[model samples]
Target: MKRTLLAASLALLTGSAFAGTTLDLGYKAHTSSTKDDNGGAYDQPFVKITHFNKADWGTLLAYLKLENPGEIADAQHGKDGKLTVKNLMIIDKQIGDSAYNWWLQNFLVSNRTVMEDNLYLGLTTNRKFDKLFINAGAGLNYSAAHFDPTGASFDGISGGAVVINAIYPMQAFNLKHRLSVNYEGQFARDDEHKSTLGYDSYGHQIITTLKTSLTDTVYTKLHLTHFDSWGSSPNDGIEYGVAIGFNF
Candidate 1:
């Protein structure tokens, strides 16, 4: 079932790529501070691809992130350093001429041993005033986790979250700049175990991105992100990176 889902996702991406697509490659380094003050840092390389049709069918986006490449980690998880791979897919459809839009997104994360998947469905609204643009969205998120080890009592766990995102964009120094904020409150109740996971948990993230033209088809990007979480799972992190990209 997992293989079939992956294949279908790849097919959709391939079909969209044949239309008009933009690709971005970048690297980022981040550090996390856990509740116990045991902090660690890692480097990540990421790729983003976006595609849209001229007939306004919708937009498709694919993003992949690799963490701790080359095994350069500041800390370790058990005997090995932390390493993770994550992929995100998003689809957006407009609601006629109104300011509303519908979106569906999926996220998959793996740590070579365990895998977690999340699905989200939401609605968004956009408003533009002069050179400034604002977008806000609310969504429902469902997540499941799988463990690789056999004989584990935790066959699978499921959870849900209320997710919100907002974006503000403007021109600065003749460059494109944007600030984005996201929040998620998650909860889960397991009947078999008579327990709850991520109960009363919440996370907030803030990101700022600046882009400037390096050439007619090339651009330079600077980005900074801060994340915080609390409740059953408490963690905080920050990431800063710069990348050079081109449009085709």
Candidate 2:
């Protein structure tokens, strides 16, 4: 009896391992309504690649994404124009059949021109019940922002986020749509120890996207976003974009 039970347990574990490995690659492009704020968003594109494999201890997740952003300049919004690099990873395991989840991510972002880098580590998980899926996670990010305005240099700000997401499927079109929202805030305190230029800033970002299938491997998407900041000198704004995507 004891031998039979042990054999059954091993078989179940082996089967679960084979069920969870997946690989995917995707690309997206966006064009802004006005070329003034940001250069002609004509070829603005982002590419992502991801892989997940079951491991002896847990799951191994790896991903990489790169973006060539157009120049964005507005007197009130500051100046943003640089190539960006982003990397992410996650590893987690199954607790029970219904609650198999992972321990968030190890992520990094870098600005090529300024030589500034930002890093973040966090935990994320998802749960499914019936036809509904719920997911949430949070993490802290640290990075330095240099004020290369010729006379002063300031470097002291931390970023963090809170997220909530859900998805439902409609039987009619055999489509599954997901809705996710995340609130991210950043705070910076002058570390230069200069009182005259000493300043702190806070800001929040919110995003929403809708996705549906157009064919067996084709898909469509719509995105909306809002960002607001408040402090000594602050700016707030909103933006929306829509596009169709293909999977190959």
Number of the top-ranking candidate, with TM-score as the measure: 1
User: On residues 87-205, what C-alpha lDDT tens digit does candidate 2 reach at each position?
Assistant: 76655554555444444455555553322333444555666566555555666655544333334443443555444555544334566444445444544523441222233345555
Instruction: Give the alpha-carbon lDDT of every model.
Output: 0.53, 0.45
TM-score between model 2 and native: 0.54
TM-score of each: 0.65, 0.54
- Candidate 2 ranges with C-alpha deviation above 4 Å: 1-82, 90-107, 111-118, 122-125, 147-160, 171-176, 185-201, 229-234
lDDT of 2: 0.45
Cα miss at 8, model 1 (Å)?
26
List ranges where model 1 is wrong by over 4 Å: 1-20, 31-41, 44-55, 69-83, 147-200, 230-234
Worst 10 residues of 2 by lDDT: 1-10
